[model samples]
Target: MAKIAFILLCHKDPDAIIKQAQSLTAVGDYMSIHFDARANPEHYQKIRDALKDNDHVTFAAKRIKCGWGEWSLVQATLNAVEAAVDAFPRATHFYMLSGDCMAIKSAEYAHELLDRRECDYIESFDYFDSDWIKTGWKEERLIYRHWFNERTQKRRFYWMFEAQKRLGITRDIPEDIEVMIGSQWWCLRRRTIEWILDFVKRRKDVMRFFRTTWIPDETFFQTIVRHLVPAHEIESRTLTFLMFSDYGMPVTFYNDHYDLLLSQDFLFARKISPDATELRRRLGVLYSSDGQRFQISNEGRSLYKFLTEKGRIGRRFASRFWEKESSLGRERELLIIVCKKWHVAKRLLERIRQMTNIPCIEYLFNEDSCPLPDLGGIQSTMGKRHRHRRALMRMLFDYYDTDRLIVCMDPANLDLLEDFGRDRSLTRILEIECHFSDEYLIGHAMRVGLAGDRTPPETIQRLLPTVRNDMTHESDRIRDANFENFLRVREVDPTDVSARAISEFLTVPQDKAHEILSHDHLYAD
Candidate 1:
């Protein structure tokens, strides 16, 4: 059983911090908190008392006076790291989070992801001229000296920073190390953290240089880890969601943000307001100790869409993959369908086979939803839990390269099919309606088998009771199907052996055969 240690950097709002600590107990067994030394003693004791009964929570002995964009923040984080590692020596992962952070995914889901991947999750990037983070990666923060500001001297250093930037008097970082920058929030393997601590101790020059730098916390871990290990060993993604507003200030989440926060596949989210009453209630249910599967509910999904459109959330990594996959399968010329009923699917396949020699693949689609839904929106659909099967359709298209059309089995999802159809490149993807009922399909199968040499008429006749009972047990939609949708896509749905031929082959009277063939009610495929 792999465990994780959390180094929680806490500030004001002791109640919020305590609630966050309790929430994290579900995922991380060991938590070492580092409160800002400037935090009021009254509130600090409140936090300590609230979490005193929580065996998982511990506090860092050495608290530092942390400043925004200052080296003290890094030291405070280091203190928490040391405390957490000492407390949980066997822990596999060490994660850094803020007191305002809350988990969104189930502990089981998060643990499974970390355990199976066995890679460090750090969001680091080699610095570029155009890169953002105007503070550290830029030369002014590195080359020029900056004094810590008094609370009264707000915006006092703004001019000095500007003057240095205009002077173009830049000093280059050490040639031996490449500069990197990324989000500070990260989950690293135990060995990665150990390696980092040892690496910094050995490199005194690197350590002293960063001490004078602005907001070194964001760059320190990333630079150290990237320099020591192979790039492939790192998963360069922080599984935490942080919201920013138009002017780049973090939005203080309230009751309205309750659903949007949980929609992300991320394990945690940050910068939540302590006063968000409704959000706290929702979080209590989601992070309850009872240990539910923790799926994103339908409301959460809708809020995700609303926020995404309004630019509240950033595009996810899956969006890039989907962009690349969208252009593929355009050259394919065959159709595939994953159906609800295998028996009905076989009959449909035979009908398609009769229409043309063109190959059609029919897979028995499952009823389960995807554990991790694709950002493609089509996969994580709510109504029918067709998410897994939808993913299967994409995989099959990739494998079969037979992309003429993929008939979605769930007719209620017509709008989604329409959305895909609107894309010119996905013209081959379309909704297909087949009008065969389970009873009719079963009868056709019986007739076909009766005509074949493999099943003698005696065998078919003997199984009459079983066949009738099986047909009777089929659901209303299956038994009452009229086969109207078949004619709509008649080009692909070839006419099977005529009713007259089947009736004669099975020794059924002509008038009864005509009535079965002439049936008009239809069901969507």
Candidate 2:
């Protein structure tokens, strides 16, 4: 029987922490908890009172004021680990976790797995060899003393950094140590942790050197464990499932991620939202169940990857709207169709696809309409609706492998018009202004329901300014107009699929063509 000792660094949410402790210690496991000194005293008291009767649970005697990217976090963790060791002398392995971390597997499974493997589970990498640091100073983070906190004192931190650079001031890392960096979370064998703690006590020079380092918690244990443990005795990956965005922010898990969580074989997952009570309760049941070993599902992993990538692309695309160079996509020509009714736009989209064999998007921004699923279900970020729509448009333009794309967009979506209007080099707009027709009014009524009473005309009326000034309007008001000529005037290729589609579209009898194009039903491709 392996006795695992869990050390949790917690700040807020007493109830969630209480539930987590109860679940882990139910099967004779030992736990040590450290509450941030900066948090309210009531939180600590509440947790203590709730777990008062559990002999398996203990609280660290020393609470430290912790801040992001500060040495206090490492110090606090050390205090908790020391407390756990003294209290639970028989603990076979030590696992470091956070308040937001949840056990995704049974305790028995973890104990048995750790017992069989009998190796330190931590990620230790040579920082200089990897591109792990996304946007910040890399080697500077270690060589230069970070006197100011990076997050709270942004200006001062940068200023001091520059001043030190100009002055050529640098600090020497403690001798006989290779600087290593990785995730702050790790699970280590009892002897490995005991060795590390003993080393810290014996070598005050190494401790002093790291005290001034930036985000020492990420490097302290990782570097030390690598220095002492043999190569084969350590695993270069963590047992905890953690993910970060392209911008280096932690990806948080919510209640909706239960299926994704169950598909992985990780022992635990961190940064689970504190308000996710249902997720916590369900995971608690799974953790306590007498279930078989968890299996890794390739389909589930791929789905998770796709979702995360979709979100990343959406965010990346949305962030570029304010910049002068906003267009980011495959280097290809883009044709966008703007119409009041989605059904009409979708019809045009299908026709274009038929002529060109190019990828056509149907109602890219229509919440009710489906976009391409393989592109990983582009989720809209609320409140920034216009920005979200524009981001998706640009991301799709970037995502498609073909040299051209036909997208159906609503005319009321003026944000994209204004956006594409600024960049006409590779983008062409084939807008159909039919807001005044009876068919348009009927489609508007059906789409908007009661809200369509006054808003349809009002919406079109508001669009008049941008349409007249920013866009080329060719309406029924134009006499003897040619569809192919309209596209040619906008610099469409004479032999392009768009031109071919329009030329064929014009060959149909006028009334029959109007009836085919004016129908209110959406085109499903």
Candidate 3:
């Protein structure tokens, strides 16, 4: 006998909200919705009238004008939770959801999943240890009392924050409770909900303390549940699939994401686009249907990782050419292979690929098409070559999910080469072709015309000295006996490679190096 009571906080779109309520409602379950006090009266009335016939649906006893980062949001949710508890006395669990949230699976599946698990599912984490907050004051959110609405009254909010900082004003969290933070949505056991409400009733001072705290909705219940419930009884993950963008805004699901949404194992998803009528309709139908259990695909999680793991450099570099000119902060090792000829560059890349398992891209800055198969149909026009180069860089660092990137750069782009060399902030290794003999220069220059433009012997000779000088400032030079041995590129002579030299350059663990170099390609001639 497992039952769930869904408490939803809605502000707009009466039709959508009614559809969601109908999807979530079942014989043994219940639904309670709290309409924002600021929303139009007509919208609220329309929703109330639409769902009035459903025996399991009830509206909150009172409406609250909710604001982001304010206590009113929590109050509204609490009102809805109270109403749901009163109406559904047999409910064994209570789940908090938003107006935009829609079930991706049948309500029966969710009940069965929760029925077997005694532990509560919520995203509770330590306020200090967890790197959860992307921006804004972390400790200040708990220590400072915020009276102004941060979303609506931005000026007053910041001014009050600054005044408090100047006056050295602070507030103390109740010592009896451990402060925790998490997503506002959760699925808690009925007993847990009762305990939280009871604690709130008895601890009026704690409620008063949180009344002026910033974004208490994300913290109030999180802190209470973690404090009252045993750690082993709580699971620090949400039943709902929630993700935020780099700017800390929730990513919205659209019509194109219908198949992707169906592939996730999560019971529900939120912040869906209002205009996504097809997606809404499909999910609504699925939620009410008792279809066969879907297999866990984890496609959503993979997409999530793809979007979020493109670190500082990858994200910035990917958008640099198309968006704006900005400085890129290097986060990982970069390997630059500078060659005057594409044939030489290709040979070196093939040799490097055979020796080490690290990924290498050929002719990344070439004027023509790049050889990469993943870059679909993006013609490399002369004007868009720089954009393609940056896109390849992003693919190496982010999509390939590698710690090191090896790229062949054209020596003709002296300005770009000089920038890479002179930027002392970057941790990079530049391997330049040092076989500057007359015969080698003539042979390579003749083949260079096939790749792009022909390079005269004197031009390379003159540029070599300048390239060396520009690169010698902050780096050390190590020359090998063989012309093809690896040169630390400064004013150094020819470059070449050996297994030991390549292994040392990579600096990977001994076992990892063995694992990488043991491939059949490395052993082949």
Candidate 4:
């Protein structure tokens, strides 16, 4: 296993820092801590006591006070790096975290990813003239002409200005270079750390340039690494939060906002607040702990329970409506319902199929499908509601073809079908009736299949025409007036089998013969 040295830069809030450290320790990873000299001694002692038994942690030689827009922070970070290197020589990577950020993934997974990305993962960028700088010094004019004019704050201002003069703003102002904004917290390969330390030591000119600059902590590493190795070696983006602020202090450490880190394929969520209890419960169903790290669990009891309960409820509801619709002598046919999850499509299809012998096809995006309660009604009036509907529609289109009658359970789903409904040539026909439940669709498909021989042709012909007419009417409404306030409906292609079927049955053209079809050609392919 690859070793990762987690370095926590601490100031105040010892309790939160201790909890964060304990969480990481529980996962079996190396940890080291540096307490800022400005911190209260009592709090520092408490922190030290908390880690008495933890052999991985150590105290640094010197302390530095870090402030916003100050060079002291960079110096403090460099000191921490030197301390970590001295203590953990065998570690492959050095991860800089804050006292507040907690570990969200198992130590094992983090180690594996670090080993894979052998290159430095820090945020680095090249300097350019367009970069924003607070100082007037260009590459040629390093010393500010206004330094002598300032009397009261002369000491501080003069020191900064004279440092910039010695450094010379020419040959690219490294401090002004824009690095991609990312989480300041990072895991960097040992080679990257060694290179940065070496670069800073050899280049006093560059050091002088950064000495007077504001927010040097943010720029120092980015500028140095970019100059040492090209931009590609360093990941332009960080997996940590960059702009997070809590209690008026800019959160510069990873430990501060552990919960907010985005989950990528490489990371598994290890810890969550009880406030996120529901999400934790869901995540737990998919993963288990191996004493050291969390891994995929084979047992799916929770998932099975959810699916069974939902499936049962859906079946019962469909049976109530199936009896009333049976008099129509309509037989169910092969039905395919495509959505983002399989459990929903499965439960619905199973319930309706139990009533009749119709074959059902279900497709889902996520591998671990858990049952969820049906959202009582569509909520597309809100912007978030509409965006979610669009995403589901895109997923559906990407996964399934148009051969099946797509019965969207919610209005958002219905609105998605409306897009294709405009061009009736699509193979997927959408049904948006309130009665269109999973069980209803299943029962309808089964009844149609079972009545294959008994149903009269006149009944079939009459039923088909009625369904087609209803769909055509809805399609007209979707295309004509601006239903944007109610549905935010977008147009879809007529070439789809569902659209084509509805168009042919309604005597509408497969191509754009009508004015409604040509109104918005934006999505036309």
Task: List model 3 lDDT by residue over 1-525, tens digit each.
Answer: 678889998776678888888777844578989988866689999998998999899888999987667899899989999998888898899899987788887766887889887989888988889988765589888787799865335457889989998999988888797888999889999999999889989999899888988989888989999989999999998889866543234556767777777678789998676666888888887765775477779677556556456543343112132233332223345666655445655655665565554567777566466554333333336455564444334433543334456777765554454444443224344454343554444444345442224556567666555544533321222222122223343213212333333445555455543444343432112
**Model 1 accuracy (lDDT, Cα):** 0.58
Listed per candidate, the RMSD to the true structure in angstroms reads: 25.1, 19.8, 20.8, 23.6
Candidate 2: Cα lDDT at 502: 51
Q: After superposition, how far is residue 490 of candidate 4 from its true place, in Å?
A: 71
Models sorted by TM-score, best on top: 2, 3, 1, 4
List candidate 4 segments past 4 Å from native.
Answer: 127-183, 242-288, 291-525
TM-score of each: 0.53, 0.60, 0.59, 0.43
What lDDT would candidate 2 get against the real structure? 0.68
Tell me the TM-score of model 4.
0.43
Among these predicted structures, which one has the highest lDDT? Answer: 2
What number of backbone clashes does candidate 1 have, counting pairs of residues 3 or more apart or in separate chains? Answer: 3
Instruction: Give lDDT tens digits, candidate 1, residues 305-324.
Output: 46555554334311211232
Task: Give the distance in Å from residue 344's predicted Cα in candidate 4 to where it truly belongs.
Answer: 69
In terms of lDDT, which candidate is stronger, 1 or 3?
A: 3
Off by over 4 Å in 1: 26-28, 134-137, 150-170, 288-525
Better of 2 and 4 by TM-score: 2
CA RMSD (A), model 4? 23.6
Model 4 lowest lDDT segment of ten: 324-333
